[model samples]
Target: MMVMVLMIASYSVGSIKVEAAEELDLQAESAIIVDAKTGKVLYEKQSDLKLPPASMTKMMTEYLVLEAISEGKIDWDTTTQVGDYAYGISADPVFSGIGLIQDKDYTVRELYEGMAIISDNATTITLAELVAGSESEFVKMMNDKAEEMGLPEYKFVNSTGLSNEDLGENYPEGTEPNADNLLSARSAALLAYHLINDYPEVLDYSSTMMSELDDQPLQNLNWMLPWEDNNFVPFHFEGVDGLKTGWTQEAGYCFTGTAKQGDRRLITVVMKTDSKEERFNQTKKLMEYGFSQFETTELFEAGYQIQDESTLSVEKGKEEQVELETSEAMEAMVKTGEEDLYELTYEINENNLNENGALTAPVEAGQVVGEAVLQYKGDNDYGYIGGIGTEQRVDLVTTTGVEKSNWFMLTMGAIGNFFSNIFTTVSDAVKGLFS
Candidate 1:
């Protein structure tokens, strides 16, 4: 949608090629890393391959629950009675679940903690049922929310992410009994991007390495977390924090991980790795590559005036032109030393201009005239998530107002223009006659 005009160099230099993350040899079937703040993609590998998300599908459930709570539709303290279906799943050891007693009321807070901490299937189903009255209805919400969030590839058949067949006779009504929730690595990463951004408190639950559910010890499945006493301390990475992990025969070992060091937070997704540890290992590689290779760099400061194109001609105004500037700073995740590869380009809002491409008189200061967009001149700019807002841009606004010329000044200008046109016509005739 950006109708770009001319580009201006943001930095004076660049030539040293920054290494791209494509060089990373991950063992996963699909993988991706993205900047949490901007949703900018740092790396991707077979990212569009649709694969089972397994318990990572619970992230959608987690998002909805938090969103519901935030909307006051449901409170954490609100209680929902566990039905026969959820209780049965809880008692089954084949699936990951903490036991739930049928017909017993459990607070949303308790069920959410159980689902998030341990990937409890029954708790997930219970929360789904609580939110939408049935797991089937919750699946509709899941698919609808996915579309709304702009996930490129995802399908939800049940709230728990278990193959509906795995749910046996209890599979939600009006769903394919054998269908399992599926998501591409890019979709998973984008979902996590929205999740942590929209509901940061999910981290409060995800970051807890250990908690108890009904006296039953619950352990976080994400081993890459920086818990000091972590049994998987060998996999721990500094700054690594809360995220979800998953595994099933179909999903293999999948993990959606996020970590923050300073103001930069990175989200990673690795799917269908050989082992539980391999998923974390692949994620660690992505984390290292992102942290080491990228930094949040300011490409252009707010109010940066583009040289040569900084002013707009104002027709019938006191001033011939009015100054323009960027309304906000343009910052993006750039390779540490590759800041110069980006240039600032601007697009004029033609609708705001006259046929002569000049602003009408009485232009207001700070009115949006166009957009200032960032253009990368380097290799492997993976772009942002969803591909909709790929262009990083800010509003191009007027730096100062331009008042309309007084009637006398306007009349004088018109008279001068009329004579100038006649003189030009006479001069052209004389030149032709001389020739």
Candidate 2:
């Protein structure tokens, strides 16, 4: 007789079943699925392997353009003049061009839409030039943003994914253009995650399966969109949205697909698949597995109580002890089906904490005073969570004529009392002798 054990995680919103011994069949050279909110890797297969990201590199380009618009350095409605450089870069056969006329003006918004929805190579280069003054400078900005996001595996050589040597027509002699862009599965997922969090408006274009620009119907390159006719890449999966797709003789096929199930959103990056259909199929399988197997659990609320233990001892104060607690509650999403529960350890800095340190002035309720580290010993490698420790200021006010007993006041009193007592004793002895 076979007995089946079912594990369920009950959350405030709903309950999710955590499947036991079930895993996703990720059929790609490299792949990763991450929680967009926490930057946690939910599932991974060769995630660190560096591979050509193909058109997914455009996500960063889109990010920089959107950032510039938000900064007021460029306006969506502002007209951008198409230059010889833009036209020259667009001529690459591998890239989708907007047929932008040289010296003709188009609003920054229109160019951005063309680059994002249509994946127009020319529009990307043109927008990069406008924002960074040149494609080279814009590439630098892309690399900078990647580093800022804590992604060290990414490198950008050009705004457009076209080969770097093809850029010589636009640049002068002795200038060698580098590879257009490169990223690992994890890094690409990070880029996509940043876009989703930073500029949700990007989905307005990425989610669009088809659009008409300049009398031409620009179809989305991402094949995850469900089509009425099942003839093309026939796999019906729900909740999938538009992202970028790429392929070359060297890069193979790559796709970054994002899907939403209720409030939970997952980003899946699959790199160097054998074919476009395989890439989408692999992504669909991974997404379905993620939704079916794991569920989110909110361990603690933002201001929930963390510790209610004995107060720490303080020196030279009216209050003998101070209450110790976290400004916020510790929360996490854990994989179900473990007999052994994970542990959250709180580490407070004894040095920064004053003797009998009651929260002092200028304290924010949720300010970090210490960190709560989480440790889990599951079949998967040990996992940890940090940054749950916090400090709040003590709202102590001095009463009239009553010396306020705080760290500052206590130190001053101790100094003054020692010197004043010594001087007074010396003067009294001298007065007695003179008398």
Candidate with maximal TM-score? 1
lDDT of 1 by residue, 1-435 (tens): 335566686674455565666678889999999999988888899999999999999999999999999999999899988888888899988875687777778899989989999899989988999899888899999999999999999999998778888888888788877888899999999999999999989999998888887789898887887667746898998887779998888899999999999999999999999998799889999999999888888778889987887888999999999988999999988887778778988899898989898899999999998998888887777888877666788899999998999999999999999999999999999999989
lDDT of 1: 0.88
TM values, all candidates: 0.93, 0.77
Q: In terms of lDDT, which candidate is strongest?
A: 1
Name the runs in model 2 displaced over 4 angstroms: 1-23, 91-94, 166-168, 171-180, 301-310, 338-340, 349-351, 355-368, 382-435
- Tell me which residue pairs clash in candidate 1: none
* Global lDDT scores for all candidate models: 0.88, 0.66
Cα lDDT tens digits, model 2, 1-435, are: 111111122223333456542356567898887766565666778877887676687899999988988898888888877778778666655455757776678888778777777678788888888998887788778888988876748777777665566566564222355454678888888788889899888888887776775676777766767766665546546777757777765668888888887777788888999987898898888787767765566454333333443234444555444443434444444555442344444555444455444434333323444544444445664121111221211211111111236777778978899999999999999999999
Estimate the overall C-alpha local distance difference test score of candidate 2: 0.66
